[model samples]
Each structure stands twice: as structure tokens, then as C-alpha cells.
Target: MSYETYAELKQLVLPHLQPIGTNYREAISGEQKLVLTLRCLATGSSFASMTVPFHMSNTSIARHVLATCEVLWKVLQPTEMPIPNEDKWKSLAKRFGDLWDYPFAIGSLDGKHVALVNPMNSESLFYNYKGYPSIVLLALSDADSCFTLVDCGQYGRVSDAGVFQASRISQLLDQERLIIPDESFMVSTTEKRIPFQVVGDEAFPLKKNLMKPYAARTLDTIKRIYNYRHCRARRPVECTFGILAKKFEIFQRPMRLQPDRAITVTNACTILHNFIRRRDGHMIDRTSEINYEIRPNNEQGLMNLRPQQGGRNSDEATEIRDLIAAFFNDPRGSVMWQDQNVFRNVLLLED
Candidate 1:
């Protein structure tokens, strides 16, 4: 986290985080408590690990961290993830097109596994495919790498699509009550048009308003180009996770707290991550992140749980993806250097 961000967060939560008594022997000062919490978050250290340096017992350290996190979550979640008006959706689309070369994209969708110990008596509930106990932190981030929506604390055993199907955000999108704009944008200077949409990897199901890349190892030129553009558009969410783990460090190591406490810690860090990105525009480039790989296609089969919808929705989704792919090849819809850049990179890889 940036120094300015740390200072701002500390200033906002300090008063609420303070103990009531004026007596030093009775309780620690707000400044000391805040410092202790920040240290744990920055280093992902256990409470017992912090006892020697902070001179506080492990119990006190845990208390301070959880209490501070609760206060921050209540104060910041509303402002950071407020429902978007029509103008806000349009603004997001404009930013996506201008910055990411993907027109009509509202945000990038992805999930990260935050490692933790297995919960007691829960048989394989939190165990992910990678043979680890964890929780999934799913988020939709805009072009600036700020989280527009976050749904954390889902079972790590579930795939990204399953997590989304179970999330309240999916309910909102399904009901068309998410305050999305109704306006359509031109995908081509001609008659081709599309509604603003979110882009994700093939882990997510395709919908009229949500896009995923074509799922195949063998791809034609246009499909590969479309996949390239779609992947680039989805990079921000991955970068957001990278930046969060890099700054908080807790995500780099398995969490030792109870499941509930682990949720609180992850939630607090998420809000703080957005706050810093909104305040300082800090985004880590993640092009070279070796651990970041697409989730296996077999793992993301989550449509059975979704509500039965009319076939028109599926048809429209295919039509939308086709229009976008055609738009990517059109002179008016295409970026001048996009084809050359993609081709050059492909050649470099082949060598």
C-alpha cells in the first residue's frame, strides 16, 4: 500500500478503533493499535508472531486486528462499491475502450484463491483442486484496477462460475436490477451495436451481457484475435489481485485464523485495496506473473445451478460475441496497430 493510503485509512478508522478509557494501563493508544493492525496486514504475520515486537499478547493482537477490520469494512464498503447510475456505466465503458481497446466493456471478472487452514468438520468444503484449503475472492475490476464489485468468502472448492452463480451480484444481474444503462453503443460505424458488458475468462458462462473467450486450443485467425483482445481486456482484474497480494502479503501465505476471522481480514484488505487504487491510481502490471494461469475448462461447468432461462438469452450471447469478433476485424472498429502487434507477438513466441 502507498504511504498516503495507509495514512488516510489510519486517520479514518482511528477514532472508532480507540479504547474509551484515558488510562494507559487500561488499554493501548489508537495509534499503537492501528500500527499493529497495519503490520499484520503488510506482512501477513500471525498474532503470536507480532507479540514480541508489539509487546502485546497474542489475544490482544487478534482482538485489535479483527476490531479494526470490522470498523473499516462498515465505513468504506458503501462509498467504494456504490450502485452505478447510467452515467457511471457509460463512463466505465468509455474508459475500457479508451484504455484497453475493448469497446463496451464495463469491467474484468476473476477470482483468486486466498489460502487458509481447513475448517473443522467441513469435509472438503474449502479444499481447492490444487490440494489446498482456501477461500475464493471473486471481484469485478474496472480499467483502473479498482474493484467495482467484490464477493469474498465463498468455498475454495467451487469454481469461479459456481461462486458467481451463488453470489448476490449474480442475482442482481439476473433480475436486471443492477442499475445498468439501457443505451447501446456502436460496435461498428455501421449498424452493428452492443450493450455494455463484462469480460471474463472461459471459466465464466457467456451471457448477453457477459463475454468469455472462445474455448479451444485450435483457433482460426479471427477467433484468436478475439481471444487476444478479450484476454487483454480481462487483465485488470488479475492485476488487481496481484497488487492486493503484493501489498497485503497475507494472501501470499496461508491464513491461520478461523474461517470467519479470515473472511474479515480478506474483506478489510479488499476495501483498503480499492481505497488505495481510487486514491493513488496504483496498479501493478501482471503480464509476467508466472502463477497466473487460466483455470481448467473442465472445472468451470456451473450452469446446472443457474435458473432456467429462455433459449433467446443464449442465442443473443452468441450473436453478441460474433459481432464483437467481426468488429475487431473491421477497419472502423479495429485499432490500427492491433493486428500487427498480435501477429508480431505470436511470431516471437513461435521462435
Candidate 2:
């Protein structure tokens, strides 16, 4: 964004802010604090580089940016939380399938590694799958590119699956509230125990809701389109990661701060990202990312009990499948798009 955009955001946030004192209690003037934050997020520059333009020390810049983030997350939007309850999710599902013309109507999941200067007790968690030191940030975003859920501070070495299972989302799933639709499921090793699956790449194990694309050689247009459409919807999460990496170059560079600081900064960038997106009236770019190759997994997964022997007895499978199919089938119907949109969201979330 340009200077005007940052200035506009500063204007919006300033009124909500608690005034800075005369002394540099947090290492800079109030104006400089906001300026440093804008530079960090809008330009994606490092603290050291940002310090030159503001004429402040790098440590001071980092402190201001972090403190400002605290204010944004805690004060400006005390009620803001990533997890959406059923009613809100149903509403989003409608927009996903209708306004966005995307498929599966579920939030996309992905992990981003924020590089950090190795800290103490980092031996186990900071290692990323890429064979480097980092912290893992797991995010789930909708087709609109807004984050519905965000998880940070896991060590880079932790697998996406591991981070997810240990997250608050996992707790939600355990309560049987995070309903996964049929198309979201993949062929599981064993099943009946935990029926809902989390959609992810092949690196993720096959469970009821976890889905993957068929091989390129075997996929037909419908399957291909389905996969493409699902991916199209999911790109927001990846795009958000890009924006964070691109704008806050610090996220891309290794960090020297504590783990808590890294987590706060990541959340701060997200809150700021939403701020910019809300102003612009959009969340994601239109460019398409089309790679569909599946990754190979070497570790064997533990087996869960399979679906009950009684076929046709489970309505869960049927209901979810229909929900997924509606994305592609309902748009062109003569009954009108809005009606279908309403009917579909109500059906999916009511149960």
C-alpha cells in the first residue's frame, strides 16, 4: 500500500488509542510508535531498516510495534476471535459457495514458518520440516481471504497435523461441533472413532473429513474443477501468508525475540491485515495457484475404527456430501441464486 493508505489507517486507529506520554516509556513517541508499526506492516521492513526512516533504535521499534499490536488485538477489538460458531460459519459458507463461487465451502488450512534467531529451549520446537529453525503459524482462512482461525508459536519442526491436533480447534472437534462435510473426507486407514476430518494435503492422514485430490493422470474435468475450485477458495490462507511475509519482512527473517513476542507480532500483523482488507473491500488476490501434486508420506498412521457395518444408516455422510455438491450445482438454477444461498447455509449449519 502507499503512504496515503497507511495514513488513512493511522487516522482510523488513533482515535481508539490511549495517548502516549511525553517520555519514551515504551522506547519512542506515540507518533513514532504508530509510524514504526505502519512501516513494519505496510512495507514489511525490518526493525533495523525501519529505524533509519523514523530515527529510532531497532529495539525501540520492535517494542512499539509489539505494544501497538497488543492494543489492536486487546483494545480495538476486544471481541475479535478467529473461531466462528455454527451460525456465523453457516453465513460464511453461503458467501463462499455463492458470492465467491468457490467449492467445499470450508476454510483453507496451511502452515507458515516465521524465521527467528534461535533462542534457548529451541532444540525441539523451532525446527521446521524444511530442515531449518523457525516457528510454525497455522491459519485457516475463508475464500474472502479473512482469517477465521489463527494458531501461532508452535516450533517449526512440528508437523501441520501435530500443531492442529494440539490446537484449540482440536478441542472444538472433540466436542463434535466442527462438522466436516463429505467431500472433505479422504479414505482413512481406520475410522469410526473420530469421524470428522480436517482438509489438508496428503501429508495429513486420511480421516472422515480430510480430503485430497486424485492423481492428475486419472482426474476428469469435474474432479479437476472440484479440486481447482476448492483450492481457489483456500488460497486466501496462502495469500495472507504471502502478504505477511512480503509486508513484514521480519516474519521472513529469523527472529531474536522471545516466543511470546513472535506470536504477538504474528497476530498483530493479522489484525493489521484485516484492517487493510476491510478498508479495500476485499481480502485475497485473483491470481490462481494451480499445483496439485500430492506429497509422499513415510510415517504410518495409527488406525481408527472403520465406519459402522450398517451401510445407509449414517446420515452424516449423505448430509455433508450434499452440502459440498451444492457449491457446484445451485448457482445456475432458475429459482435464483439468493434463495439457494439462504437454503444451503441454513441446511449445513442447522445440524
Candidate 3:
């Protein structure tokens, strides 16, 4: 929060966190508690380390951080990461189209592993394929890079698709409980309709409401163009994760908290990230952030291809993808630069 906004927020949350008094001794002030919690989050200091400055026991520091985080989430969740209604979903899609030129895109989805020190007696559960002990922080971010929905504490070992499949939001999406509009939008001048959907990497399975890039092996111009556009649309979520990790240094290093506490801290950081984005306006577009993993030649498949699970129904996905490819190839929906940028060297190679 900015210096100007801190007092206002502190006042709003003070009533809930204020300690009850019995005339025996004065309790810690809410401002002090908030400061300590913010300090720990900003610095990723261990409870023991924070005790020195706060003049409190390690246990007290931990308790204060967890309790304050719960309160922050409870009060801030409705505004920060409220469930998307039809109008809001449409707004998100509209923004995606305006900024990224991808129509009917709801939001971008991705997962990142927050490193953790091994917990007592349960080491194997947190061990990930990257050969580290951590927990997954799967999130869906909007066009402006604010987190719309987040699910933390999934086992680090789980693949992006697995973490998504087991998430509560997945259950909601599968049962159509989110009420994501049954609406479709025109992707072409001829009125080819494509459903509004969230885009993810190849790790996520394709559904009517979710889209992923086409594999990069083919030489077809249409598929390559579609893949390039889809990858661009998915960049926001990756940028969100990048900004979140950069802002919260804890994610850059292994956290020494227990699994449950780690979840609380992770959720707290995510909530605070949105808080800063909303109040402080620290949203920066990192679209040009250099990623060595994705070279310009085959940038379409930058999002790694994990084993696709739980789908034998990619027929509709394939059809929609083909339609999008056709749209990009058409003169109406085609950007002027795409023809040269996408097919520049390919045509030379063909010749």
C-alpha cells in the first residue's frame, strides 16, 4: 500500500484484529501487528528472525502472521478474487481481445512451484520433478495481470493439469457451476462462432471452455498462425507468475515453513499481490520478458507439452482451433504484420 493509503486500510481492518482488553495489560495494537505481518511477507523472514525486531517470541510472530493473513483473505477475497459472473467474464474476454487480439478469451491459466524445505516425516509428497520440495500455486490471472482465482498447496509433484484437475475450481468448471456464459463470439467475418474460454499451455487439457495451443510440428500456415496467437494470449498468466515471484522473494528461495503454514503464506501473498495491483497499481506488462525456453523460431509451443490427461474429446477442440487458424489466415481478422512475421522465413525455407 502507498503511504497515503496505508492508514485507510489499517483502519478498515483494525476492528477485526483489535485485541480484547481485560484491564490487566495492554495488547499489541493492530497497526503493530499489521506492520509485523507485512514485514514478514515483504522480507520472507522466518518467525525466529522476525522476533528480534518485533520483540516477540517466534511462536507469537508465527501466530500473528497466520491470523492476520486469514483475516486479510476473509475480508479481501470478495473484492480481490471474486467469482466471475457473465458480465465480468465478458469484460475479461473483451480486454483480452483488445490487448492481445484474441477474441473470446476469458483469462490465462498457469502454475508455478513455490519451493519449500522438507516437512517432518512427509518428504516424498513435496518432492517435484524438478528435484525440489515445494508446493504448487496454480492461478488464473486476468488481462491486467490481477489474480482472479488461486489454488495453493497442491503437491509440487503434480503436473499443471493434475493440479488443475484436482482443484475446487475444476470441479466447479466441470459441473458448470461457475456459470461461465454459454455465449460464443464471432472469430471471422462469416460469423464463425467460438465459445469464450480460458487459455493454458499444452499441460492443460482442451475443453469447450478451455483452449491450448496446437502442437508445433506441422508445417501448415494456418495452424502456426493460430498457435502464435494462442501463445500470446496465454502470456498474461506467465507474466503474473513472474511478477508475483519477483515481488515476493520468498518464492525465489525455499520457505522454511510447514506445509499447512506454507499454504497460508502462499494464499496471503497472492491476496496481497492483488491488493497491490488494485490499490497501488503496480501492474506491469512483461510480455517482452525474455524467456530462453521459447525461441522465436518455434515460439508457438513455448508452453511445454506435458502429457495430456483425461481427454479423448479433442475433436471439438481441433475444430475450433482449425476455425481460429482460418480466421487468422483470412483478410478480415488477420493482422497486417502476422503474414510477414509468422511466415517470413518459412516461405524462404520452402523455396
RMSD in angstroms between candidate 3 and the native structure over all alpha carbons:
7.6
Name the runs in model 3 displaced over 4 angstroms.
22-24, 189-191, 282-310, 343-347
Ranking of all candidate structures by their lDDT, best first: 1, 3, 2
lDDT of 3 by residue, 86-158 (tens): 8898778767776777766789988989898887787688899989898898888888888988989899889
Which ten-residue region of model 3 has the weakest summed lDDT? 288-297
Candidate number with greatest TM-score: 3
State each model's CA lDDT, in order. Answer: 0.79, 0.57, 0.77
TM-scores for all candidates?
A: 0.87, 0.67, 0.88
Write candidate 2's Cα lDDT for 1-351 as tens digits: 556767876665666555655564653455666766766765557778776678778777777788887776764343345556655655565455453454234666777778777768767677676776777787777666666677788877877778877776656655556643322222222222122233455344333354444345765434444445445556667776786676666665676677888788788777766666666645443432211111122233221224333423234433333334333333331123334433453333444
Residue pairs with colliding backbones in model 3 are none
The better candidate by TM-score, 1 or 3, is 3
Cα lDDT over the full model 2: 0.57
* lDDT, residue 134, model 2: 78
The Cα error of candidate 3 at residue 231, in Å, is 1.1
